[model samples]
Target: MSDTSGALVLFSGGQDSTVCLAWALSRFEHVETVGFDYGQKHAVELRARDEVRRNITARFPQWADRLGEDHMLEMRGFGAVAQSALTADRAIEMTEKGLPSTFVPGRNLVFFVYAAALADRRGLKTMIGGMCETDFSGYPDCRRDTLDAVQTALNLGMEQDFIIETPLMRLTKAETWGLAKSLGGEDLVDLVVRDSHTCYQGDREHFHDWGYGCETCPACELRAKGWNEWVAEGRPTLAA
Candidate 1:
């Protein structure tokens, strides 16, 4: 039997996180998924997470035994401080600094910290997140430097050797799609397109080949652009 122990993924039931989840499952003998109720405007992604989990387990039963239960955390005050389209009911727009309205302040920081806490308690040493700088909406926390700093801080503060992994950190959105297809083939791609939610507005009605969303929001635009670019390049093998 596989060692059946490895890492936890900071899963958001979005395209990137779902791909990260698949990546973690491929490498780890055991994997647990964590989501946060951070008072985001698009809480629908939480529901989508459940559905995506079911789809993954059903389609990839070989991983069922090692795939642990989902962990949902309540961050009651996140919306009060984050103050973005993800937490507010306003039109999705960009900030003066070129960041999209969905850029929640220190959101990824809190997420990584809490995920580290969970890992410490569970004796897990690795935690994976899906934050990407390429093809992103200009969120500062999604950058590689931020993640690196957070990793260092997490170790110093908790006195634990936790290895935070960002599998999608460098991959473009199109490359992410390609990586998913490469890792798990059609099943993974299907789950991402049909189940993952990346819309700033949580618009589920507008379905596209890339995925479903408002199709005009920053998230959808980025996804669509990536898909187009991928196609233009003959859908070449995207580097991880």
Candidate 2:
């Protein structure tokens, strides 16, 4: 058995959450992961999640031993109500409008509500996520202020003391890449690009200059811009 100070991470099998997972392994005595099955169009994302669990377990089997198998909590029904292009029938369009069609309404809210319950039951006071505002274009839930409000609401509704920790909230995507490289060696970036899921369309068969980032989409554009800047600064690029 590991130590008692446990943490529950809302893992999405993406670059940011993978970094958080590695960070959690180093900090907590016991670290557990919770992933969602939100019925996103790309079933490949779920497959990617499985791959991420396998890789994490292989890398840190001791942590796996202590934490048990990765818990992929199912919320398939909830996804039916998610009308956003990211998880629904609508086409994902790039826009400078208020929010993108990919923005799933109340996604973070739903994730943390369930995470709070799980954490409270397991005596885990810390709940970590990978939501970032710096590079995020228009996701309301990814904002720092939105997270703070949700944190307060979760504590009030649950009547339990819990901390929603967002280590990547303030860091730009480039900075996040740097942090992951620092923590898990430079090779970790390659692991993220190959294994992690970030595409709104859920395309995984191709690799762009910025890993799986779809070159045409806004997310891909931002990620590509950041990676180009990082490389222009003579940073190392993780190979596939």
Candidate 3:
């Protein structure tokens, strides 16, 4: 938070991004969120993003003040080329590379580039995103090395000093749940469970202790497993 102007969060209204948003509010003087509409089949994510933001604002006014402007840019062009279940009408499948069908090529890269542009224009030197290598699908872009390369490329391209923050880069899904608790306690974690959208299927109707999801998609399975393990491990609190 120190030596920074402000922070912009690349929010997806999902479990990880929600935690990142709360994390930013706790540490930064000013924070903003930006989401993408990349023609994903789960369109509810767009509405969920705004809903989660509103809930956070109403519940934590002080933190909400630090949470500044938000953007939900339309990015259907990503679906045009990527053959992923996220943007295509197909069942999730595994690949030889160990990545699932949900893996959207260049999605994270595109997001970072757009986020960098927004941050540069707003004089925000820090950009936060919720990409974790742990407890994540086999998406290569979620790796630390990939993010580092993207950050380097973005800074060199923009000719601006930008700090790309990944608060949950190494954290598990359960650890992320613990992070929410550490940031704002049980209420915050509960809010995340109730408000965040992590389902690849956009199934918000069904709810669970971990979160609302289809419970069958890769994201839901991972989240459920991590949360169950964390709870079994006495629900240990993590440092913010």
* Local distance difference test scores for all models: 0.85, 0.76, 0.88
Which candidate tops lDDT?
3
Stretches of model 3 off by over 4 angstroms after superposition: none
Q: Write the per-residue lDDT of candidate 3 for residues 174-219, one digit (tens) a residue.
A: 7887888889888788888888888999998898889899999998
- For all predictions, the C-alpha RMSD in Å is 2.3, 3.8, 1.1
Model 3 quality (TM-score): 0.97
The numbered model that scores best in TM-score is 3
Model 2: residues with Cα > 4 Å off, grouped in runs: 1-4, 60-67, 94-97, 236-240
Off by over 4 Å in 1: 1-4
Answer with 2 or 3, whichever has the higher lDDT.
3
Instruction: Score every model by TM-score.
Output: 0.94, 0.88, 0.97
The CA root-mean-square deviation of candidate 1, after full C-alpha superposition on the true structure, stands at 2.3
Better of 2 and 3 by TM-score: 3
Taking all chains together, the TM-score of candidate 1 against the true structure is 0.94
Q: How well is each residue in 99-193 modelled by candidate 2, as lDDT tens digits?
A: 78888778889999888888888788899898998888678899889888988998888897788888888877777777767766665666776
| Tens digits of lDDT, candidate 1, 50-92 | 9998988899988777788689999958768778877877667
